[model samples]
Target chain A: MALATLKNVRFAGMATCVPRRILSNINDCPPSLRSERERLVRNIGIETRRICQEWQCLSDLAYDAANRLIDQLGWKKEDIDGLIVVTQSPDYLIPSTAIILQDRLGLEHTTIAYDVNLGCSGYPFGLHLLGSLIATGSVRKGLLVVGDKSATIKDPLFSDAGTVTALEFRENSNPWFFDLNSDGSGFKAIMLPVGGHRNPVKFFHLIPSEDEHGILHLPTDLILDGTAVLSFSTQRVPPAVEKTLAYANKKIDEIDYFLFHQANKMINETIRKKLRLPEERVPSTLKEFGNTSGASIPVTITARLREKLTEGSKQLLLGGFGIGLSWGTAIIKVEEACLPELIEA
Target chain B: MEEFIEKFQEAVDFQDPVEVTENTVLLDLPEWDSLAALGVIVMFDIEYGKTITGDHLLKSKTIKDLFELTVA
Candidate 1:
């Protein structure tokens, strides 16, 4: 039960940046999946996804999003005390992406900058990380840049984007409640077996091979066991959500919106039904952006509830699960968050 | 057992109306594919409150075998 409430911290604003290229699962299906295109689109709920150009990387998108958010919030880069980047995709194998982003964002050299290796569960976890730091009051403000530009595998299941969530210290603010958990035994449920030190990239890993489903994959590519992942998410997420609500001493109905990590249509829908939340209360970006991995939660908020989040005060319950076999829930208050228009790079 | 069979039919959602019995070799059906497997997995989890893995789905040959795994 990793549950805690961080005080003296509030969300200032957030911005999301996605690649300009849009690839439709229905219109641009590979020959192997062409026959099941309609069925896949219906069940998975990913109509299209944004893909980065060959020259672009995840850091590029994160940098753009951070700049947009900083500019929108009208904050000086030097005032920021910390920068935490959450991404499984890095600009390079060495020296955390946050360091690069720190220099790129023109933040002070004294700022605390680092990266967390996570996917799907990254956003809520990143919030907890930076929120706790800011709660200390020594760290006045910080940027949580989380997202991923998945491998160019030509699968609609993966989309590319980055987001920057700006959080600042404000005494007597509403406490942010969070419950985070991870199961290492199920890490294999979604993994890249190669390219890591455990299994160094080999010649064979570079060559593409067809799986039983006829979808081709390189050994270095992400291998997702849909059945295992679906079962894990459905069973794990609902409990975490309930626990977070209970931890906050808040009821499910009190939350104005439920933002779930946009894994897919089926997984999210199943979790929603288990919690008995109405479809209207749970917003989804899956239909348009597919699964942007860590970026899904913020991207969905920026894409779907931009106006409401920007103009009104609301209670939000966010659930992020999958990858690292991890899951977490957060209950927070958003009051006129300074959200800018979605950026394309 | 009959209830399980009916729900399984609904979950798999074959294009053609196909009669599924306890003895039916589920994987042998033309409509039984990865998507169908996912459907059954979700059904078992949501309806039976049992979490069955991809390995369990592959190891079970007949519909009865799957039902047993769900209840076992």
Candidate 2:
């Protein structure tokens, strides 16, 4: 059980950026999916999603969001001592995206910058990683930029978006409790089949292939074993939520909101129902943003509960799971965090 | 078995016109896709409190085979 309580770190604010191009799962669905579009939309719970232009990358969105958040928080670029970029859709395989983002954001040379390869679980995991540095007095302030340009091959299942979370060192702040777990055995549940070091990209991998469903995808594209993911998420997330609450000595009712990674409507609803949480407590970005991968939880917060989170203090229980078959839950208080409105690029 | 058939039909959202039975070849159904498989998995989890994997769904030739997997 990778459970810990980090103290003295305050969530300053967060901002999110999505491309201006929108793809409606209903109106923009391909001909192959046209027949079952309504059923797909209803079950998946994503009516529309933002997509990136060809020139855009995950870093571009993240850069915009980080700039906006820094400006909103009134933080100087020189003061940001740590930069953590978490994503599965990085710009390059050579240099870590964080290094590039550090330069792009014009942060000081003393800032610690790197990247963490993760998908849905990236947000909470990134917080734990960066918050540690802040808590230890090694870094006074840090930026956690998490995003994914997951709209590969124009697949409606994934969306493109970036989010930046600012955390500052504060004295006697409320402790943030987290329960994180991972299962490498279930890595195949959600993954790109090829293009990695183990399965190096080849000419054949670049060729588009058709699955039984008649949807065409390259071998390097994300292949989701829906049944496996559904089972893992529905079973694993509920217990993880319970464990986090227990770790924090908090009860379900004490949580003002439960923000889950907007993987899909069906998977999220299953987890919510298993936990017996009311519909209103669990805010979702699935309808507008679809599955924004790592950025989903914060994206949901900025899109749905901006006014509430920006105005008053709220206890939030966040659940993020999938891709690495990894899942984690964090219990934290949003004390008037500067949650800006969603930005369109 | 009759109850299982009805539950399976509902899980897959098959219309009443398309009758399903114990011997019904599930793969033959036009709606039998990854989404339907996910539905059945969720159905088993919610209704029977059983965990069924994609392999179990793929290997089960008929609705009876699927129900038998839940027999335990």
Candidate 3:
């Protein structure tokens, strides 16, 4: 039997959440004690960092963003029939973060709520999953929440942030097409070394220290092979974009804008150069916020919309890739569901 | 060596002088961070084929200790 065909879905609203704690350049630290790693932060183009206060969790960020989107769109909690929260950081590993969000938001128990453990490629993949569900008549209104706290990794390269995109299922409309893929073999490219099933927490505690370069060092902490990740991103990301465009029977020039995951300044710059996209078409927030994992893309979109860069645009090419060694892309036509201005936070 | 230290200090946004003495306390300097640690590690590994970890630096409180470890 042939597989069932899925219909098109539209994104109606967007919102983002960032912690109040801002680590800016103005913060004082002695120069003679500076480390090489500290220098890398300045060189990498990050200006400020955000961290959730001690009492907050990943769900809090997701809920804040979701509530803001709901408020901006004048959407009732009952209107949302489905919710998908894509995050790698959870308050507890046992119960999914979505269930907690659903209860907190006063969503109906019947609401299809679940969590997808994903990073980097999460925004596009979550969009694809929700779009498929809406198209198949599984639910009418769906909310895709993407966020993560790199604090768990103890890596300053990541910031605490979340984003919510409300998607409305529209009939007879040519919704965007998505191309998704994953290769688990390269999962080690970027990962946290502790706090998992394989490497449970033990008696020994590891803290940050300073190396010869005067940089604070945290060995036995989050270890990322920067070169490996850079090579993977530069190699896999562009092809994913090109293949998706080809599948949609569209050319690079036909794409109005490209919203990619804000992995870093270097990766984004490399991809932009490789794709030969106009500087105006690509949006990035790594310089100010660092990498917010899954929240990067929607946050970028919201930022661009606020800047008036997305006004009057129809075709937008969205791509997100990272972490799972996973990546994907999609193309959507802007409509009323696409709100230009909402929550700026 | 002094020029390298100067560039390193500038790269890490340290306000101190470029002339780093062997006994300078790295932890007392303001430019230390995870990124700076990685940069120093890469620099030492590339220039002198030395690999130092956070634990090693934690044991040594001064620049003289680091130089000794690197040269040894």
Worst 10 residues of 2 chain A by lDDT: A29-38
> What would the C-alpha RMSD of candidate 1 be, to one decimal place?
2.0
Give one digit per residue, the lDDT tens place, for model 3 in A258-330.
Answer: 9988877666876787788888889778777788888888777776655443355467788888887888787
Q: Write the per-residue lDDT of candidate 1 for residues A1-345, one digit (tens) a residue.
A: 599899999999999999999988878766766666777777788898999999999999989999889998999998998999999989998899999989988999989999999999999999999999999875798999999988364677989999999999999989899999989999888998888899999887888887766667777877888888888898889988998898899998899999999998889988998899999999999988889999999999999889999899999998899999898899999998999999999
Q: In candidate 2, residue A12 scores what lDDT?
A: 98
TM-score of chain B of each: 0.94, 0.90, 0.67
Error of 2 at A139 (Å): 1.1
The sequence of per-residue lDDT tens digits that candidate 1 reaches over residues B1-72 is: 999988988887665668888999976788788778888888887788788878998899999899898769
Superposed on all Cα atoms, model 2 deviates from the true structure by an RMSD in Å of: 1.9
Candidate 3 residue-wise lDDT, B29-69, digit = tens: 76565444544544444345555554565677776676666
How high is each candidate's TM-score?
0.94, 0.95, 0.77
| lDDT values for all models | 0.89, 0.88, 0.72
CAPRI quality of model 2: medium
The parts of candidate 3 lying over 4 Å away from their true place are: A1-6, A25-30, A33-42, A151-154, A205-220, A307-313, A338-345, B1-72
Q: Give me the candidate number with maximum lDDT.
A: 1
Model 3 DockQ vs. reference: 0.08
iRMS for all predictions? 1.8, 1.9, 7.6
lDDT of 2 at A279: 97
